[model samples]
Target chain A: MLFRRIYQFLIVYCIGLTCLLAIKKILVLSDYVIPGIPLILDTFGQVFRGYFFDVLNTLSVTILGQIISIIMAFAVGILGRKSSWAGSFVKVMAYNIQAYPIVALAPIIFILLGDGFISRLLIASMICYFPLLLSVLGIMASPVKDIEHFYIATGRMRWQLEVKIRAFENLSKLTTVIAGSATLAMAGTIVAEFIAANAGIGYSIRIALYQSDLARILAALFMIGIVISVYQGILETLGAQLKTKWSAPKEGELL
Target chain B: MHLECDGLKYTYPGAKAAVIDNLCFTMTAPGFNAVFGPSGVGKTSLAKLLVSRGNRQESCISTFDIDTILYSYNQERLPNWSSIGSHLNKICPIGKETLKKELIEIFKLKPLLAARFSQLSMGQQNRVNLIRYLLQEFDLLILDESLANVDEALRETIILAIKTLFPGKMFLYISHNLMEVAKFCREILILGESTKQRKNFMVRGRDYTQGYTLDKKAFDATMLEIMNAF
Candidate 1:
C-alpha cells in the first residue's frame, strides 16, 4: 500500500511538471512579449533557478509557522475542553480572529513586524491558526458521552483521557485539518511574500509583474500550485494510513 | 458500598423547570435496583446525576456519594471496539486480559470486536457498551436504557452473566422496559413527573411481576395509584 501511494504521488508530480513545461513552451512560441520589451530567451535558466529558490524560501517559513500554530491549537483545544470558561474564551477569540479579514490584518502585521521573516511567519501563522484551532476545538469538544464520563469516573487524568480517547476517536478529523491548514499556510506565505518579503515566490511574482514578464509570473503561479498540491497529497496519504491504523473496519469487511 | 443522592434538583439550560427536583434515593451494594418512569421524567438525568456524584452544574445543590459509578445510556457514546484490548487496557489496566477473554466469551463479542462501533448493529453496540463497564470495578453501575436495543435472549444472557460474575457489586438498571426490570431487579424506584412535588416511590420488583411474566397492566395500575397517593 505504501509503495502504491508513493508511485501515485510521483506520477501526479510528473504530470504537473509536464503541464507547466507545456504552458511555458506555448507562451514562448506565441512571442507574447510586452510592448517595448526585448524577446530574451537567454534568461530562461536564470528565471527557473530564481523561482526554485523562492519556493524553497516560502515553504521553509510556511512549514515552520504551520507546525507551531498546530501545536498551539492543540494545546488550546485541550485547555478549552477541560474548563468551560476557558473554552468559551478561546471560542470567542477564535471567532473574532476568523471574522477578521486576512487582507486587512496583513498590513497591520507588516507595519508591526516590519518587512522580514518574522513578519512573514506571523502572517502565515495567523492565517493558518484559526481554521486549524477551530477544527481541533470542535473535535475535542465532541462528547463521547458514556465513554467520556466513564473515563472521568475511573479517574483517568486529562492527558490520559486525551490520548486514550479523544486522539484516537478524532484521528481522521485532525488529519483533515492538517491537510486544510497546509493549503492555507501556503496561501498565507505567498500573500506575506507579496506584501513584505524581499525573497520567495511571492517576491518573484512581484518582480515578474513589474517587468511584464508574463511567462515568469505564470511559472511562479504554477510552482505555487504544484507545491500546495504535493503538500496536500502527502497529508492525504498520511490521513489514509492513520484511518486504517486507528479506525475500525466497516461491517462485513475483513480487517 | 451504598449509592446515595439527596435533595437533587436539575434544570436544563433555557428550560422553565427542573427535570429532577428535590429527589432522594439510596441503594446498597449486592443489590439489583431499577429506576423507571415514562419518557422525559428525568430518569436519564437521575442516572447522570448519580454517576457524576451530583457535580452536574445544571443541577442546583444536588449531592451524591458514590465511590465509582460507571454509567451508560446509549450505544453512540461507546468508543470503537476494533481494538478491544487497547480500550480495555485503559479502563481496566489490571486483569484486563482475563476480563476481556471472559466478556468476549460470555457476550459472544469476539466476532464484533474487530468492527467499529458505528458498523455494528444497534444490538451489538449495546452489548459491547454494557460489556465495557463489566471489565472495570465500580461501586455502582447505572445502565440507563443501555440495553434497549439488545435482543431479549442476549440481554438476559448479559444480566445473568453480571449476576454470576459480579455478585457483590450494585447494579442500577434504569429503563422503561418493565419486563426486563421484573426479571432482574429486586427493588424499583419510580420517579415522579411533577417538578414542584417530590412524588417518587419505591416498591419491590416482585409487586410488578405476575408469575413468569411482567404484568404491564398491574404495574401501570400500581404506578397510577402511587402517583395519585402523592
Candidate 2:
C-alpha cells in the first residue's frame, strides 16, 4: 500500500513537472516565470532539508487536527443517528456550519486564536470535520436492519451495540472516509500557514511566491504531496488490518 | 399463557387497504404453532404485529402476558464482521452454554462456527441466524420462514430438534411448506388466499412432537383443510 501510494504520487508529480517544463520551453519564459531544470535542482538541494522539516511541522498539525475531527465527527454522528428532533437539529446545525466557506471563516478564526499552532490546528480540524461527520452520520443513521432486528426482537438492543454493529458493517466505508480526509487536513493546515502562519511549508511557499521563485514553490509542492501520500497510505493500511482482524476466525470458537 | 387478537386491524403507512382487517384469534397453548398463508397474504405483517413493541391503543393483537416475543425470518442477517461463533458467544446469555451447544450440534453449525456470516452459504447462514435467537431468552419465538433455504431433511431435523429441546416454550413456525407445518406444528393459523379475501383463522395440526408418527390419512386431511383455507 505504501509503495503504491508513493509511486502514484511520483507519477503525478513527474507529469506536472514535465508539463511546466514544456510550457516554459514553448513560451520562452524567463527563469523567473518557470525555472530551468538546473535552477530547480539547485533550489531543491538548498531547501530540501528545511522544506522537509517544514512539511513535518505541517504534518504534525495535520495529524492532530485529524484526530480531533475524527473524535468530533463520531461523537456527533452517534448522537445524531436517531431520527429524533435532536438528531434533526444536529443535522441542520452541521449543514449550516458547513455552508459558510472556510476561506472566509479563516480570517475570523485567526483573529480570535492568533496565527499560531492552535489556529492552524483549528482550521485544519474545521476543514476535515464536516465531510467526515456527514459520512459518519450517513453510515450511522442508516440502520443495519438485517442484524439490528435480531437484537431488537430479543429485547437485547443497546445503544453501544447498535453503534458497533453499524460501524463494523460499514468499516470499509468509514476507513475510506478517514483516509480521504487526511488530504483535507493537510490542505487546511497549508492554507492556514499561507494566509498568516510563519513556520510551516505553507508559510515557506508564501515567501517563495512573494519572491517569485517558481523553483522553491515546485520543491514545496513535491514535499507536501509525498508526505500526504505516505500518511494516507499508512491510514489505509491500518484500515485494511482492522477489517481483516475483525473478520478473522476465532480459535476454538465453539467454546 | 394466552395470546389473543381481538378486532386486530393494521394498515401500513401510505398503504391503500388494511393488510390485516378485523383479525381475531386466541392461542391458548404453547408448542410449535404456525402462521401460514400464501405469498403476499400478510403473514409477515401478522408476524410483525404479533411481536411488535409499538403502540397498542389501536392494535387488537394482545400478548401482554408474554414477556418477550422474538421474530426471526429468512432474510435476517447476522453481523458480518465476526465469526458465527463469536456472534453466538456474544449474544448467548450466561448459564446457557448447554443449550447453545445442543443447538449448535443439532443445527450442524459446529463446522461453520469459525466462519464469518458472509462466508457461509444461504442455508448455513439461516442455521446460524436461527441458533442465535434460540440461545436468547424469549417467551414466544416467531420463525417467519426462517429456514427457507435449508434442505428439507435438514430443516425437518432442525425443527424436530427445536421441538424436542424447547418443549416448554412457544414457537410460531411460519412457512410456505404446508406439509411441514401440518406434520410438525401443533396448530396452524391460516390467513386468507389473497388481498381481496383476507380471512384469518386457526386450525389444529398434528402434534408429531407428541410421539405421533406421520399417519398418511391424518396428514392428508390436515393438508386438505390448510389448502382449502387459501
Candidate 3:
C-alpha cells in the first residue's frame, strides 16, 4: 500500500530530475559568454523564482476546477441513477466530451468564457469531468445483486439507495478515480493557459520561448512537474487512508 | 400470511416463446415448500416473480398477493458479511440486535464477517447470503438455489435452523435436488411440462404425501417418474 502511494510521486520526480539535468547540460554547452559561475547562478535564481509563482497560479486553477468538476459529476451521477433516461443522456454526453480533444475545445471555451481564469477553470473542469462522471456511474451500475435486492425489499427510496448504499460501496473506487484524474486536470489547466492566459507556468513558458530564454522555459516545465507531483501526492495519500479505514478486513482477520 | 400468483406468464424480450406460461401456485404460512424443477425450467423466473413481482424491466403480467417477500439467490451482490448484516439491520430495525446475534450464531458467520464477498469460498458466501435474508422479517422467504453451493451437513443444519427459528414464516426452497427438498419441505410445487403441452404445472405436497419426512429412495423414484411422465 505504501509503495502504491509513492509510485506516482517517484515517476514524476524522475521525469522532473531528468529535465533539470538536461537544462543544466544545455546551460553548460551554450555559446553565450558567461564571464563567471556567479552569472549563471544569478540567471538560474531569477528563473526559479518566476517559475515558482507561475506554477502556483496554475496549481490553484487546476485544484479549484477539479473540485467543481467532481461535485458536478456526482450531482449528474445521482440524477442519472434516479431516472433511466437522464442517466443514458448523461452517459452519451460524457462519452462525447471525453472523445472531443481538449486542444480543439480550448479555443472555443476561451472565446465563450473569455481569456481569463474562468476559461482556464472551464477547460480544466471539462477535461476532468468525464472520467469522474464515468467512474461514479460505472460504480453505481455495477451489479451488486444482493444489495439491490435488499434495497428493493426494504422499499428504500431512490436517493437512499444512491447515497447510502451505492456511494458507500464504491467509495474506494471513487477515491482512486479522483486521484487518477489529477494529471489530466493539470494538463487541461496548462493547455488553457497556453492558449490564452496572462499568468501561469504555461504563460511563463510562452514568454520564455518568445525571448529565447531556454533556462526559464526549463524552469517552468520543471515547476509544472513539481505542482502536479504535489497534487497527486496529496490525493494518493488521502486515497490510501480512505482505503485503510473503509476497506473490508483481510480474509483471515477476525471481525 | 400467504403467497399466491395467478395466470403468470413471462416471456423474455426478443424471445419466440414464453418461459413461464399461465403458472399459478399458493403457499401458506407455517409451512416450508419446495419448488422442484429440472434445469432451465424457469424455476428462477418463478422465484423472481414470486418475490418481487418481476424485475423492473419486465412487464408485469402476473398478479401477486404478498407485498414483502425476502429472497436469496446464489449469485450474491454482497460486498461483505458485515455490510450484509448492517443492511439487514437497516431494513428491519425492530429486534435488530437479537436477530443479528441469533443469525450469526446459527449460520456460524462470525469468522467470515470481515472478509469481502469475493474473498470467501462459494460455500461460505452461500451461508452468509442465507443468513443475510434470514435476518430480515418477511411474510414469505424465497431461497432460490441459495444452498446449492453448501455442503450436505451445512445444508441440513440451515434447514433445521430455519424450521426451528422461523416456524411462522413461509419458505419456498427452490432447488433441483429432490431428496433435500423432500427432507425439509412438507409441500412440493413441481413446475414441469403438462400433458396438454403446457410449459408449466403445479403439484401439491399432498400429491406425494402430506408429511415432512419422506423415504429418500422412494421420493427420488417418484420424482423421476413425475419428471419422465411430464
Candidate 4:
C-alpha cells in the first residue's frame, strides 16, 4: 500500500511537471515564469536540505493539529450522540463554529497569539476540526439498532456500552475517516504557514512567490507532496492493521 | 407468572386500520405459551407492545408478578466485533455460569463460540442470539420466531432444552410453525387472518417437555385445531 501511494504520487507529479514544461514551451516563457528542468533541478540542489527540514517542521504541527482535532471531534461527537436538548445544542454550536471561514479568522488568531507555533497550531486545528466533527457526529448519532435492542431488552444499555457498540460497529468507517483527514491536517498546517507563520515550508513558498522564483515553489511543492503521501500511506496501513486486530481477536482476547 | 390482557388494542402510526383490535387473553401459570398467526398478522407488533408495558389507559396487557419481560426475535443481531463466547460471558449473570455452559452445550454452540457473529450462518447466529438472552435475568421471555432459521431437529432440541432447563419461568414462543407450537406449548393463541375478523382463540397444546412426547394422533389433532382456529 505504501509503495503504491508513493508511485501514484510520482506519476501525478511527473504529469504535472510535463504540463508546465509544455505550457512554458508554447508561450516562450522565461525561467522565472516557468522554470526549465535544469533550473528546477538546480534550485532543488541548492535548497533540498533546507526545504526538507522546513517540511518536517510543518509536519510536526500537522500531526499535533490532527491530534487536537481528533480529540475535539470525539468529545463533541459523544456529547451530541443523543437527541436531547444539550446534545442538539452542542451539535448546533459546532456547526456554527465551522461555518466561520478559518482564513477570515486567521488574522485575529495571529493578532492574539502572534506568528508563532501556537497560532499555527490553533489555525491548523480549527481548519481540520469541522469536517471530522461532522463525520464523528454522524457515526455516533446513528444507532446500530440490531445490536442495541438486545442491550435495551436486557436493561444493560448504559451510556458507555452504547458508545462502545456504536464505535465498534463503525470502526472501519472511522479508520477511513481518520486516515483521509491526514490530508486536511497537512493542508491546514500549510495554509497556516502560507498566511502568517514565519517558519515551515509554507513560509518558504511565500518567499518564493514574492521573488517570482517558480523553481523554488516547484521544489517546495515536491517536498510537500512526497511527505504528505508518505504520512497518509503510513496512516492507512495502521488503520488496516487495527481493523484486522479488532475484527479477528486472538483466542484469549475474545472479550 | 400470570399474563392477562383485557381489551388489548394497538394501531401503528400512519396506518389505515388497527393491527391488533380489542384482543384479549389470559395465561395463569408459568409455562411455554405461544402466539401463532400467519404472515403480517402483527405478531411482532404485539410482542413490542407486550415488552413496552403497553398504554394502560388504552389497553391493559398486564404481566402480574413478572418484573422483567424480554423479547427476543430471529432478526436480532449480536455485536460482530467480538466472539459469541465473549458475548455470552459479558451477558451471563454472576451465578448463571453453570446454566450458560449447559445452554451452550444444548444449543451445540461450543465449537462456534470462538467465531464472530458475522462469521456464523443464519441458524447459528439465531442460536447464539437466543443463548445470550437465556443467560440474562428475565422473568418472562418472548421468543418471536427466535429459532426460525434452524432446522426442525435442532429447533426441537433447543425448545425441549429450554423447557427442561427453565421450568418455573414463562416463555412466550411466537411462531408460524404449527407442529412445534402444538407439541411444545401448553397454550397457543391463534390470531385471525385480519383484525376485522376479531376471531382470536386459544387452544390447549400437548405441552411436551424433554421426557414427555404425546401420541401422534393427539399431536395431529392439536395441530389441526390450531390451524383451523387461525
- Name model 2 segments beyond 4 Å from true: A250-255, B195-198
What TM-score does chain B alone reach in each candidate, compared with the true chain B? 0.78, 0.94, 0.78, 0.95
- Each candidate's number of clashing pairs is 0, 0, 0, 0
Candidate 4 chain A weakest ten by summed lDDT = A246-255
User: Pick by lDDT: which candidate is best?
Assistant: 2
Report how far residue B31 has shifted in candidate 4, in Å.
Answer: 0.9
Write one digit per residue (lDDT tens) for candidate 4, span B1-230. 79988878887899988898778899888989999988877788888888888445555787777988899988888877788898899889999999999999989999998888878889999999999898888889999889988999999999999988888889999998888899999988888867335568789999998878579999989988877764
RMSD of candidates 1 onward, in order: 6.4, 2.8, 5.3, 2.5
Ranking by DockQ: 4, 2, 1, 3
What lDDT does the true structure give each of the candidates? 0.72, 0.89, 0.71, 0.88
User: Is candidate 2 or 4 superior in lDDT?
Assistant: 2
Which tens-of-lDDT digit does each residue in A52-135 have in candidate 3? 888889889989999999999888777665447777888788777778776688888877878889998998888998888888
Encode model 2's per-residue lDDT on A79-173: one tens digit a residue.
99899999999988888888877767899999998989999999999999999999999999999888899888777889999999999989999
In Å, residue A121's CA in model 4 sits off its true spot by 0.3
If candidate 2 were superposed on the true structure by all CA atoms, what would the RMSD be? Answer: 2.8
Clashes of 1: 0
Write down the RMSD of candidate 3 (Cα, Å).
5.3
User: Which residue pairs in candidate 4 have backbone atoms (N, alpha carbon, C) closer than 3 angstroms, thus clashing?
Assistant: none
Model 1 lDDT, residue A3, Cα: 54
lDDT of 2 at A36: 93
- State TM-scores per candidate: 0.74, 0.93, 0.78, 0.94
Q: Output the number of the TM-score-best candidate.
A: 4
